[model samples]
Target: MKVVIFETDAPLPIARAKHGSYGDMFKALLQRAPSFATAGPVEYIQLHIHADKPDGDVRDFPPLEDVDAIIITGSRSNAYDTHIPWINQLTDYVKHALAEESKTRVVGICFGHQIIGRALDLQVGPNPAGWELSLTEMALTSEGETHLTTAAKEDNKLALMQFHRDIVFPPLPENVTTLAQTDVCAVQGMHRPRKLWSVQGHPEFDTEIERELLEYAAGTGMDRKIIDAAIAKLENQETRVERDRAAVADAMAAFLLE
Candidate 1:
């Protein structure tokens, strides 16, 4: 399988030291999927469209037919930001990819999720409730139950490691079915049949990565209470591996393959 990794931001020092890069992290996570077992060799092509300033060019990219999937990694920048030069450009590209007929399946995480919403002309901004960080349990909607397969849920809720404040707002496009919800964020996930799938939480993030983000937030002058609480939640979670990571990976892999 040939998957294109669309990187929106670089990883922090600690995360990079362990995971190499955001693309590397996603590749590692996807490899955990059972589908990958029989899928043979996989090729991950990283594209730094935002960082490299691609200037609205697709000629340099591989033909869409060759791409099995495109996973958009989370970013530090807001999806609705007007200052970032490439934010809109990325949105435009994603919009085109989602709208046009192609073999490529698109998946978004965090900023990637919000950018997809922006592309669809839905509202994107901070959650009115507050930031949802660390290991958070999200209740799956009926649609989420059908589309998002996971055995890690208790009371029909799955725990995912998260670190984001902004969200893809409600009343999403009519074509997409909302997957999950939390008190803090209503649209925890959304799926558009075979074309796209996305989650607000970071399925690609491991314990080390989530911990690094929490500590990084602490140093960045984020609210002491928020940082401390997020750190506490991380510490309270089960050992090294998260319980739901594999389930999420398999779900994504199944969607991408479909």
Candidate 2:
């Protein structure tokens, strides 16, 4: 299968040194799925939306009909920020892609999730509860239990890696069903039938990358207490990373192959 990744941001220098680019991280995460492992060969095309060409404009993206599936990567840029023309263009591109075809499945992670929410006219902005950093426990909704192939079937709750200050607030768009949620963020995962699927957490994140991120955040002079808490949470929940990665990858594979 052919997949196009819309990369909105590059990884921090510290993290990038260890894990490579965000596109590489996502490719590694998705390849962990058993289905993807045996699905013959898969081709991935990465489009960096954060960069502008010599013409001082973001490069035009390929049409939705040209690929089997699309995955939008997390970004530091806020979806609601109109100052960034590329962000607005990317949001419009997502809306246009979904509107043009129903067969192309799209998955959004973190900033990507908020972008899709904004594209659908849902309220996407900062969370009143503040940043949801490090590892977090998310409970599956009834729809999640019944419809989500990504969740652990035997367990109602799953631990996922999260790093976001923004959220996709209710009421969700028509036909959209929330799959999972946490106390801090009401919309952790959502599916809009055959068109789109999105999750607030970072399935592509691993312990090492998160550690680098924490260090990077510390260098930024963010609150030391927040960094320490994130470190503690990361250390405590490190074991669950592999399990969550496999579950999410399986779900993504299923969505793409469906």
Candidate 3:
């Protein structure tokens, strides 16, 4: 399997915060994909772009056609930031990926989801009231239950590790369809035609990272009581690391084989 990973500034060797480390998550994801280790030599590439290295320097990278699947991760930067240097290139990358004829699969997580939507003609902006942190419920829309279930291992809710400030609200592309939505956020999960998929939460984070995120969020401008409640609630939430890793690996494997 050929997988291309787009890293959004967080888990690089040099980082301001240690909570968003994804290198371990990527290894875990590969291990979770039952076919990954045993499959005919899996190829995984990491694409880095962050505040420290805004240039993104894709000059040494291989041609896009060599990739069979793409995974774009979230960043601390906002998708609507017109001043960000890499924003345009990132948007173009999404548009090009979606427009490819080789059935190239793309998976966007968090900032990746928002940027992909914007590239596909959707408007991405702040939540106005702010964003949801920690674990929250994403009540599946009827459509969500049908198609999104393909990624689920069993019949139950999929609670992901979420940390975002911007939300997506514009209409999806003609070829796209909604798979899930929460009371506060629509398009929590979406699929493009049949090969591409994206989710607004983080399925790559482990238990330690999740806890770190919750603690960090609690200290922000959030109300003391509300933050306390969220932290308390997080204590009872399901870790689902194993389940999520399996689901993501399954989805990626299926996309590649198809």
Candidate 4:
């Protein structure tokens, strides 16, 4: 399978100790979904858009005829922003891929999820209470579990890495179904019958990557007490490697195959 990575945000240099940049996170995701492509066979491209300058032309990338799948990564900005130049184009592209006779399959994470919602006419914005950033347990609904059974062979419970202030509300699109949910968020994962899907949390994140993000958040003037508390809670913490990775890989593969 030929997979194309569409990075909506850029991570700071690792030399700066900013930790898992968008590229790094996606690379880890690909590691879990190894069946999707060979080593270095996955093509990665970037769209650099920030608060200051959020517009760019993506007309030069490979056409849909050459793509088997297109994965969109999370962004630091909201999907409702009017500043991001390529935001509308990205939305249109996703909608088109899922339209009749399109081969490009899409999977969105974090901000990517929000963008998918927006593209499909669902609303996405900040949660009334604010962001939820922690290692949390999410239970797969029957539909979620069924999908997992096709793609996953390990534990049913998933301990996910997450950090998002905004979430989708009022349920998903009419054609979409909720696969999983936590106490905090309802739309953990969604399936549009077939051809497109999305997950709210970061299944691609590992301990080292999460640590880097925490450190970066601290440096960015996020509450020291909050950061310290979160770190302490996550102390000596190591994610379960095999089961979680396999589940994610399986779920994604099954969704794509459908």
Best by TM-score: 2
Please, what is the TM-score per model? 0.90, 0.91, 0.82, 0.83
- Cα lDDT tens digits, model 2, 1-258, are 778888888887777887788888888887887887788887899887753331235667777677777889888778888667788887887887678445667889998898889888889889989989888888889976654444356778777788889999988866888989999899998886668888899988888777777788889898989989988987756567777777788777666766
lDDT of each prediction vs. the true structure? 0.81, 0.80, 0.67, 0.69
Give the residue spans of candidate 2 off by over 4 A.
51-57, 100-102, 146-155
After TM-score superposition, the amount by which residue 83's alpha carbon in candidate 1 deviates from its true location, in angstroms, is 3.8
Error of 1 at 126 (Å): 2.0
Q: Give the worst 10-residue stretch by lDDT in candidate 4.
A: 44-53
Off by over 4 Å in 3: 12-24, 35-38, 54-61, 146-156, 218-223, 239-241
Worst 10 residues of 1 by lDDT: 50-59
- Candidate 1 or 4, higher TM-score? 1
lDDT of 4 by residue, 55-157 (tens): 6554555677787777777777788775666787777777787776988888888887888888778877888876677566678877787765522334566
lDDT of 3 by residue, 210-232 (tens): 66655665667656776666566
Which is the better candidate, 1 or 4, if ranked by lDDT?
1
State which candidate, 2 or 3, has the greater TM-score: 2
lDDT score for candidate 2 against the true structure? 0.80
What residue pairs clash in candidate 1, if any at all?
none
Best by lDDT: 1
